[model samples]
Target: MLTAADAELARRETRVTAFGLVLDPAALRDRLAARLPEAPRAVRVDYLRYKPGTSVLAGLVLDTGAGPVRAYAKAFTPEGAPEKLAKHRGLAARAAAGAGGGDVSADWHSVVDEPAHLVVGTARADRRLPGVGQLAERPGRATGPDASVRTLRYKPERRWVGVLGHERPARLLKAHPPARAAAALAGHRALAAAGLPVPAAERVHPQRCRGLLSLAWVHGTALDAAPADERVLAEVGALLARVHAVAPALAAGREAAPARPGLDAAAAAVGVLLPGLAAEARAVARTAAARLADRPRTVVHGDFSADQVMVAADGVWLTDLDQVRIDDPLADLGGYLAAEIADGRVPPGTDPYDALAPLLAGYRPCGARLDRRALAAHTAAALLRRTAEPFRHRHPDWPVRAATLLTAARDLLEQP
Candidate 1:
């Protein structure tokens, strides 16, 4: 059924089915034979990232003589198959000289399964993400500087963010495709220029290395990782108000109204990955479409959540500014509310919104008046859009969890 999309995207036949083969360990052991020192003792991988009819990126841990070597592989459409063979080979050679440590090294490889009609590129590091090695060299601590790079997140060909050192990192290095380099720089620079409690941006580029964005680490425990103090909530609320006060030009794009809710792609993704819940996901989308109240747009931190902030004596620091855009202020409020409810910290059998009391109390005084309807609708929209995350994150019982999130979204939209 997925192959039905080939003609539409100009992808090869079985483009979707072929990518699935790469996830089969028995098949991978043979396809990647040249790279493995011997028959792989075992293969560990998860269907971590998938874009139907396009690509799939998965984390891999292979048993080898040296122990489990961590790596990644991306299986993609073969429209430009012939040309990428040489490109991948060249990049693989270049990466062999790049510095790396830990489970995965910088070495790379590629293999094409002609029968599958797909190009599979595998690497210990993200070749598409530029300048990580250079950013890793920056200080990892204020004084002693442990400086070991630890992956915070990875979504191949899209993003790879790593924190330097441990416990308390001194820096965060991000690598996205170069085409998005300018937008990434603008978001942070604008926030910093506005005197927000966000990290200062340091550009990474020189003749020898590729361009990347490096951020001074925000010191303090992240709110999501620990209990969030009321004071921390207040500080975060005040900081967000300041961000909304910033001129719209500070961030370049505007978010679409919820009536045209951006969950269309996410809903479609549900159809492919969790077909049983696809209809409910679509119904939730429709309910959200009619529930949003019109409001003036402001600068919004497009992806605000408890995980996006770190509290310290000096200030509450914000990170992850890539999604900065002009939109309904309630959009951010929704992001926060959705995360709070989804986090499961709220006592069982109690209304989830009770968790937002401290946050909203802190918000109303410093920020615009709350629009209860808009907030409810926006939160539902956020939950709906994120319903696919459980599957994408490789949870073993993802379907049940994903269904719970959908139920929450539907309930939120039902609010009168």
Candidate 2:
């Protein structure tokens, strides 16, 4: 637990890195006044959570005389790396030198960088990580579980699927949950309507300031561990094709995927966090992003892999809709194949592309075409992104594993 003073310090540091200024209640109030003068009361900023390497000063709620605004403010060290921040400071200096300089409202982008905010804020705002016991007694929403919240997965996001005595049916509690649970709820309905097989979303709840999404639990083992063979892999590909076929229809009113983190952002994220790999990460990101530039776009599972698909007697069920987006479909394929390769599911020294054959065979039958360049580019990006996580989580083999992935990414990018 972070002390109030510690939280405040983190907030200040985050603001400095995010924007070239430190913001407090008074500063925030003045800025709000400038942006929307109707609210004149002092701003109350509450810090929710901060996981330094991953995000800084996340989950903030701004309460003003007008209303309460929830903002997920995250400043990654790389984004705030001394060099990048210096440029922003230089911009601030130039703006300040002008008559209307230093005013937060003067630069609309700084005060309201919707892209950055939405990318970090929406994610951080709604979801929280808490223990299983804490959840059963959580304020506002508490259910005395018949059994422990049997956790399913605990990386990138926390999840559990189990029974609540009164609910009778099995239920799922997804944590570090989504900021856009409502959006996801809508998405689930749309996908179901489109004839895709997805587990239903029961409800969205906030437990003790933490976010939770209750889903109608579907009992199945992940295909990665289930009785999966080539046919199963092909079926997975076909299912993905089905998703693509109806993605445009399901994506109504939803935002297209945000821009890829790209080389600069990736470099910055890794550089800021790892420091030792700053230069190396920058060079890698630059090469990878350049290679990945401009591919055809389609609906994609933003975080697809074998593990996300569940197999049961009924059929194959797709899970984790939090990252559904409009991007290159090959991104989904690349992510899946990359995971297979990295996890050692693919035999060592075997060409990863060879492993993609059965999937492509299934996919192409559904009228989708594959671009070799796009596939290679996105696959490399996926591998490179994997390298950043170990460092953030402080895994013991992060150095060796990161090096291996970095090399693989570089090799992919340089391939003819």
Candidate 3:
């Protein structure tokens, strides 16, 4: 007994609601195709939920038979004046064709200004694998002997299109507040000026409604696959030292604040969904915070980890500059070391104390021996942050890993 308008509204709501439900790429394709009758011939899709706070954007690749074409799609609630539907359609058509270079869908303008081009690029990058389309059709083939290119996706919602080939290092920044994007850009420039290897800034697009400020891509491979050799680690360590050496600038024109609480909050949020280790995890965070309260302040990568570090033919490139801020250097060191330890590549007892020597030698600090107490404190705090990562929509094993990190933190707290 529903009117046609009512039915259409229901359909739109259903698609939006799917964001909360478990994602099924195949099912998503069907829904998308139903909406667009002029569907491309062959299709490949990949979804990734990179981090909490960014929205999810879906990447779809269509084999137009001419060649591969990519597009990104996201949904949003209508806002602003109730203009005529035709007006909205006209605006969408212009924006889609103007910004998307005919690769984007016109339907997207009805929801938002334009689909996030960054997200679209990311999706295209993931689909470049030789058998990705085949893998999509045969789900079981995902683990087969195929050289797959990983897609980088973040949330509250982000998606990209284009082949992000393995060797192409990319940088992704969720610039919710315009200031954050500006700051990230400043940081990247600073690294480049310092003679450190970092990606050049490309573009900044504002997603007003979604509160995203997208930046240009940084090309490189995350150091996630394996621990670097001693020499590589030493070089990386030196790079970190040099990065820290750049005189602290209020790059974002923002004052520094105590980061301990932020780290605690991240952990507490994680603990909420991971009730089993909630108490212990919170305790570890608090202990780390208290211990690092007196650490010397410097520019530290707030969320540094193996994923943040990329190794490329050019050299090591650090991505994710949005979290760049003045803090204890140990925060970066600790978080990275904790990741290494958690990955089981570095034994807990293996002393990395001397590892800094080569790095320091390379950096040639103005003063020998940077503050160790503060470094250790920041390290502890970094571990706490890692232990408290949000688990919603994350893999089932994530919480287990968080719990394991909590255990490691507790052990570190007991040391000396």
Candidate 4:
């Protein structure tokens, strides 16, 4: 017979082993009650974002024995949790005001200046309507292990997304939190002015301590799962070229690139967590760093990958503009190629360079030149960095995969 203590342990283990999460429904209810006392009993808890043993951000629905009310609950061990929560509350208040078409003088800045606050199904006081139409909250795409990076969609074409991870590794962010959101908003506007298909940033709350960005949803399917062909790939290449073309204007009056991947630093970062592979990872980083010297720099999409670009019937559009910055253009190309290669877009033992030929061919005519050495170096760094990411902690085979990528990075660095 299983003891009570054993049963609780098994239940927690199930949560971690199965869903990559350990959530306490009772604790979640208590938090919700504190925030929304008048709301009824919490009948259900949904995990929107879960990083096992680290953090879990969830969506809660309460039934006041009358109707349902929705709210968010976050549980984590990162530093400054109290401050982050306070910031989020401010963001939520601003979002509420925006949705209600209230003045935003205190909390927000307008990017496009259009009324993007009213989501499709939200209750708006329209002179033309008879009764309030109930709006449904839909789940948006999940980016990674950190639940905070996911989206909470109030409508199909509009979303509430923000950076909720506090104290993320320094390698991920060089600028402070508020600056990161402001830069991203700047990127969105610049891309839109340049005639790119990115979504319009509607309302942004970028205070000195914390910030959040809510984008008007651009309807589309993610290219990673889309049925992409040469035509589709060509469109993607052309758009990237267009992005690079506008880098200079975006970076104007702003700080230079936030961080550069130095070989020594990259190796040190990787080795700090995985001591066994420190020597080899550092050696590869050093070689790649030397080869990357004197490469041309431009505004690169810091986190470009197939999943980041979306494909709609009209055209291709990109999302997650948070990492935009001035850097080697090849970093964008290399990051995309690295993701594709890891996802098996390139067959094992086949050169990713060869596989990327058509895309590069499409890009060349758009006035961007391809540098093999720079691309390889950036690609190696991208792969090495992936080994230390939060997502790696959840993957059962991450050890084998990380080692394989490191070896591959060494080989890529060996290329002339």
Provide the TM-score for each candidate, comma-separated: 0.81, 0.63, 0.60, 0.60
Over 311-412, each residue of candidate 1 has an lDDT whose tens digit, in order, gives: 766878888998787788888888887776667665222343565677766676884677776777788888887787776655545676678878888877
Identify the leading candidate in terms of lDDT: 1
C-alpha lDDT score of every prediction, in listed order: 0.65, 0.55, 0.49, 0.52
lDDT of 2 by residue, 1-416 (tens): 23343344344555334332212445544545654425446443333223543444433334544244333333445444445334433433333211111110111112333323312222111123332223433322433322333333333233333343333435666554445455656666767778888887745444443445667777778888986477877788899998877757577666453335655676666555456777877776776666556767666667888888988778788887877767777888878877876787774234556878877777889999877766777777787677665544434455666667766766776667
For candidate 1, what is the TM-score? 0.81
Model 3 worst lDDT window (10 residues): 116-125
lDDT of 2: 0.55
Better of 2 and 4 by TM-score: 2
Off by over 4 Å in 3: 1-20, 23-152, 157-179, 202-227, 250-255, 307-315, 342-344, 347-376, 388-393
Which candidate, 3 or 4, would have the higher lDDT against the true structure?
4
| Candidate 1 lDDT for residue 409 | 84
Each prediction's RMSD over C-alphas, in Å, is 5.2, 14.1, 11.0, 12.6
Candidate 1: C-alpha lDDT: 0.65
- Predicted structure 2, TM vs. truth: 0.63
lDDT ranking, best first: 1, 2, 4, 3
Span of 10 residues, lowest total lDDT, candidate 1: 1-10
